[model samples]
Target: MRHARPLPTYLVQRYHGWKATAYHENKAWYRRLAKEGQHPRAMVISCCDSRVHVTSIFGADQGEFFIHRNIANLVPPHKPDGDLHGTSAALEYAVNVLKVAHIVVMGHSNCGGVKGCYDMCSGHAPELEEQASYVGRWMDLLRPGYERTAEIADPAERTRAMERQAVLVSLENLMTFPFVREAVEGEVMTLHGLWNDIGEGDLECYDPAKGDFVRV
Candidate 1:
């Protein structure tokens, strides 16, 4: 039989402290926010990494951004499955329901998904074929980019190439939805790509001018 485990003592204490602070110190903001609906101006597509906090990075207050997080923040080709597509659902809601003006797809350093695709494309991660998971299938979108970029000599270059490729793929996939395409072409909606590094606190933007991500 499995034994019952206790919650992390530190986490429990933090949770209680946060609850007390919210109830005592931040009640007004919470009450107003709770009564009103979110009217965010942007939707940010980001990874599920614990270190990458979108709110902290963007310096946004509550209800500023509608965030959609997946394994690698991939916007898959729109498929009408009669079921919910998590990322696509957020896009539809943000664009149609909320009418957000900007949609930002933020990629980052040391991305496990990009690294996984690089490994698979270079014949280093054969197990991807055996594991028929969503991540395995979703990450296949980067195959062409990884294959093309691996011809370079440096591993660092290949990783960077893969990272940028994922962002570009997401941007392209966003257009696969007819609504997104229409909104984008009509100039009512805009798309952006951003890169981040935790160690150096370096933020970069994908510059259309230079055709690369440079320091912001």
Candidate 2:
């Protein structure tokens, strides 16, 4: 711990500014949140990409949303093998413990995780094909999406398709959990898929009936 470097001056200054402004402005709300444990109505699973600001996009206040972020915002199929499953653990807590009425898997444009999967699957990144590549292995969950999008002739369009695929895949995998299935079937919980176009500041929601993402 002693070897850890001191916080950067710029980050420290920014934190102080935020603490003085936003923290001061919402002092009473913050205290209330601290006294009463969070009871968020929704849980959002989103990408770790720096550009994707889930709270900012949704204008969410503190403790309004219980969020979990990982590369590509993926959710693996339910596997009760007692292994280390960070996403699954978050899902379990959100659905069972928090009892959030809604679960949203939100993906974004130009995601590095999705791009890396495309490169590896398209033979553009041979190094990623190695056994030791953690990213490559994690992205294997998106391979089915890649396969479905590979036939597209337009590179840009294919990438967009893959991005949406990430959302669809997560939605499908979410149902693999028995609790999730029960909640959804009993109308106790609802699942949603969303994609954000960072550049254009556009949002899209998946329409299961049309099997495509519709701009919102």
lDDT of 2 by residue, 51-142 (tens): 99999999998898999999999999999994439999999999999999999999999999999999899899988899888888889899
Model 1 spans > 4 angstroms off:
1-7, 81-84
Task: Quantify all predictions' global Cα lDDT against the true fold.
Answer: 0.83, 0.94
Task: Give, for candidate 2, the lowest lDDT window spanning 10 residues.
Answer: 75-84
Per-prediction tally of clashes: 0, 0
Best by TM-score: 2
Q: Residue by residue across 159-195, what tens digits does model 1's lDDT show?
A: 9777777787788889999999999899998999888
- Top model number, lDDT: 2
TM-score of each: 0.89, 0.96
lDDT of 2 at 151: 76
Q: How far off is residue 142 in model 2, in Å?
A: 0.1
